[model samples]
Target chain A: MPAGPTERPTIGVALKWVDLRPEVDPLTGAIHDDLHSFGCSEADRAALEWALRLAESWPGGDVDGERAEPPDVVVVTAGPAEADALVRDALAAGATRGVLVDVAPDAPSPEVAALLTGVLEGADLVCCGDYSVDRGSGSVPAFLAAGLGAVQALGLVHLEREPSGTLRVTRRLDHGRREVLAVQAPAVLSFEGASAELRRAGLAAVLSARDIAIDVVPAIAGRVARTQVTRRAPYRPRSRSLRPPAADLDVRGRVLSLTGALVERTPPRTIRADAAEAANLVIDQLRTWGYLE
Target chain B: MTEPRTPDFDVIVVGSGPAGASAALVLARAGKRVCLLERGPFPGSKNMYGGVVYGRILDTLIPRWWEEAPIQRWVTRRGTVIMTEQQSLTIDYRTTAWGEAPYNGATTFRPDFDSWLAGHATDAGAVLVTSTTATGLLRDGAGRVTGVRTDRPDGDLSASLVIACDGVNSFLAKEAGLYPHAVPENFTLGAKEVLALPRDEIDKRFGLTGHEGADFEIVGCTRGIAGGGFVYTNLDSIAVGVVLSVTQLATAKVRPEELIADLKRHPMVAPWVEGADLKEYSAHLIPEAGYDMMPTLAADGMLIAGDAAAMCLAAGIWLEGVNFAIGSGKAAGEAALEALVTGDVTAEGLAGYRSRLDDSFVLADHKRLRRVPELLMSERMQTQYPQLMCNLVEGMFTVTNPTPKKGVVALGWQELRRAKVKIRHLLRDLWTSVRTFG
Candidate 1:
């Protein structure tokens, strides 16, 4: 691992190189066979190929597709213990440094940090997607900040590396408005949709990735000193399209927002309903599904 | 039809109405490659629900479908009546078989029904492209319709044969010069409104139980014009409309919407639609000019089906158009596919389209009722006869209620003389009907 930087924040990103789903073949009931769909038009296939090329142009990341080289950055991913051998092989193959983010789906927050801290004790930086595609909760990275006792920025959109080994960051806020902030080299940053276009790895990069492996350890998150109880139902497919805030939500002005805007009400308004009670319902539901503290 | 998307497509059907979709569904189920194009955003968005669909023909397409399809109800009550100034002499029929699994008849919302059919086509590997209208036949110099040109970019698609299932006022028909314009006043325009109500409330108001529905056809209500009004029961709403001759509506300068509003306000009509919310109100033109409106079916390159061929029969009593649309669409599909296999999409290859139609009663029904259109225009139906009915029925019920009025058990001649309905006009009108309808 690289020596701890006295002034620069170093970070690692998490990704799962998931393949196309295997369930697609069951449309005709022969579920376990090698099946390929040929129903698409030629033009549509051309469009997908073009999107892949755009994904390969990014300047950073440990994996290189086509002519792009790795930017001295390592992507942290975890699955079964069998993947440990792959991680060891990658570190042995010319990768001098690594940062492990506790990414196990059902891992306790404290347990995740315990494992990550042991592996990344020397690193001064961590990078995370603002919102994971599956969850989009916009949480985990902030929680990591509390667990690891690091200064964290939860709204990271743009980032650049300078010659002096400093990292520049930008954040999204107030409906198309943005802010630039910097912290001396060793803090956590979150990524959101504001990040530059996602880069897709080509066949050559994927083959090269087989040599990369990551070590996993248990991370122990301390007891939750505070809890927010909120109940929100799962989204329905038909009602997925969300409109902008109605005139009621006065979100048009500037405020250093640390959370999503709250619902607006008429003047002289008072809410009799217990906010904690509503939150408790949500926490209870998540706990029932083994996803809560 | 072998519409070669540069290699293989078992069938390429044009239009997305009942005819095209049904054909595509059948061919696709047999493991054939099918491509169905719709000009509208969806099937039947361009359709006019002018009459009750004949549920029998649909039975052939989707077996016992009322259990699942978005059907209003199975029709149990049907009425055809003539009204006078104060009296209506009505004829009604009540059939219970209409409620059984193999239903005798059912009311349909065309957009819902046709969209469901297009879904079946999709499941059978038929690609349905919506919002794309086929402009004209792309023909080889040898005069075979080799493909079609569409309004979309890069939409020049090749096919072995073309089937025109476009409806009543088909652009393809006129562009091909297959259908001639109807004589003045021969066709009619209909405006309809679907009013929403709860299902249970609709049943109680319409005097039906379970899935029984009603269709009430009116006469003498067009106000001396050559048409009347209709009310058909749907799932949770009532469909009401008036069909009037284009010529009469133009001359009287009365719009169909205004006429329908008047009908809805009628003391009797208003009660049936009470508490119902207005959902959709639209006007559609029907080519009921019949023989005069018939379009040529076969050309060198294509076959015409459905309302595009002017296959609707007004029946003088009411309109029945959807079943014919489905049947003709099926027949055209079968003929088109056969023509593709034989490599003969010529006029001769399509001659089977008409001949088979003759056997299937789609064409036969039109031929049988060929004279009914002209015969419905007897002068008595317009003037002398209606007054006679009003005078006769109203006089039969009306009374001076005075003394010595033949003991009040009689329809006296004195009451008839008071109405100016002379014996000469009534006799001549009666004789004209005997020579025509009798």
Candidate 2:
């Protein structure tokens, strides 16, 4: 972290590269013959967008009536050489620089986390998606927070830095509830899909980003593996039986019957006969779902 | 000749379709600084075509291109089929020549083909900027086009020359006063679907071995509307679609998608694509107005090529556009080079562009088939001719018990009568067809 008011803070974004297979493939389990291009995972895009947004609103720790300068945004990812495209995309999405951690495609989660920890050492705040779209392990942010000894917030929808240097975050909870928390610097926040959509990368930025030099660092050894893939299977679509209108019914009867069947499938359970009864029903349902406890 | 560099690039090519990419490839290979701008995320992400790439212009650019390009199949069999609701008449010709080296034609999916072609341009040292729309043309004080104004921030890119290869509705050409707003009658709406099947299954169904494929062009399946249907085989997929006259489609009051669905259910077409799964569905506007709707090819510091200049040929027997685009693009490239060498990048200097195209097969073919669009889009050709042909073929093949067979000419006349076609109109159409096609 920088110390002076003129010094800009560093915001780190962890990215994951994915192989995007074409949407069309034969049902005979044959490999897709279409070309595959490199793309960043959706969750990683959301986190990067959030990091860029937060950097724009950074207060700069200024107390002398000077306008606040934006923070420097840096993106870090670990993968093979092809992952350079992902880092370039992040730069086009408004990152100041990029760090590519050289690793294999099958690098374990713990090893990736350790490499990311080394790259994000001096950053004031580090952000990542809740999980990779390809591998929904939902554990990288936790592992990274533990390795960095920083406070971790998962599923954040909103984040901003206060003038006093504390980070305010809003996490979406179940049943339309939100949890807001304020923490000190050097924290890790994992974003959910509820955050704002990523900005469209401009062509100029994309062309310029192609020229930015990506710092490639070799991976560190001695990390225990946490997971292993054992099996591979092609997607099998579930067969659904067709439910047509009854042959004996008229058109009006068929329409009415379909509507009645839909209503019966999800019948409303509670009837608000009175205020007291409604309150009792709510409380009983909450207790039954274990939310009351 | 060389001069002091004043602009950002020597040439700026708008759009990355065949024309733009080919121009960029030629210019960049000649050691000129060029920029290829595309409005899509990538080159082919926004481009669509019916599925056939006819002609050998590509061979001159990238020799034996099919060996490395994403070519789906080389067409070995091709013909047209005239269809009535329940009957059909096909005139197909197949040969081993088309499958050998220097093939006649080939089929490809645009998404794969366009990107690969653009890649060649980039490999030859052209800077390809995707997702950047050229909003307007930059003009100097004397009203000469100097560059393009894109949709990017501070995206005013200046160049000595600008080539507008943008597709049918080219904003740059329209802004430069080269093309007028297109009318509905001058355009055609094409909708296509990619149906995926197993490679072996496709090979077995189409009776093809190795990379051989077939192309079928169908008529009289548009429900009396002015259009036609087509089916082209890919490696493991079939591109089936229809091209309709926009003017007729609007009054026909039928959805284009429904028209394709009805085409898929045709008795003759259903068996070919029965069990295939739909992979992708797309639609695009094609500039079908042959030589009549062509825009001004070149002006001061500006040259228009490809569909933006209405270089597509939508004649009856030969429906082609990509080849013409590539041909015109090569001519434009050569002309631009000449203009650059003489240090006179102006309308008078670039006049060689039109002359080069006139000297090539692009202009000659379009000029010869200038009346085909009018003939193909006529009410009689769309309905009566196909109905008459199908009826005559049906009559010739059917043998009724205890009845004598009529002569071929008599049967044709009887079918023509049944289709409510007058002999005078038939004679006139035949004369026009012969004169126009020959």
Across residues B219-312, which tens digit of lDDT does each residue of candidate 2 receive? 8878887878898999989989999988889998988889888888988889889988888899999998799888888889999999999999
- lDDT at residue B163 of model 1 (Cα atoms): 70
Question: Chain B alone, model 2: TM-score?
Answer: 0.97
Q: State the C-alpha lDDT per candidate.
A: 0.63, 0.84
Off by over 4 Å in 2: A1-8, A19-38, A41-43, A56-71, A80-82, A102-108, A200-204, A218-227, A234-293, B1-5
Weakest lDDT window of 10 consecutive positions for candidate 2 chain A: A27-36
Which digits, one per residue and each the tens of the lDDT, describe model 1 over residues A120-149?
Answer: 454455565555443235555666666566
lDDT of 2 at B266: 86
* Tens digit of per-residue lDDT, candidate 1, span B327-347: 888888778777767878789
For lDDT, the strongest prediction is: 2
TM-score for each candidate, following the candidate numbering: 0.60, 0.88
Residue A1 accuracy (lDDT) in model 2:
47
In model 2, which residue pairs have backbone atoms overlapping below 3 Å? none
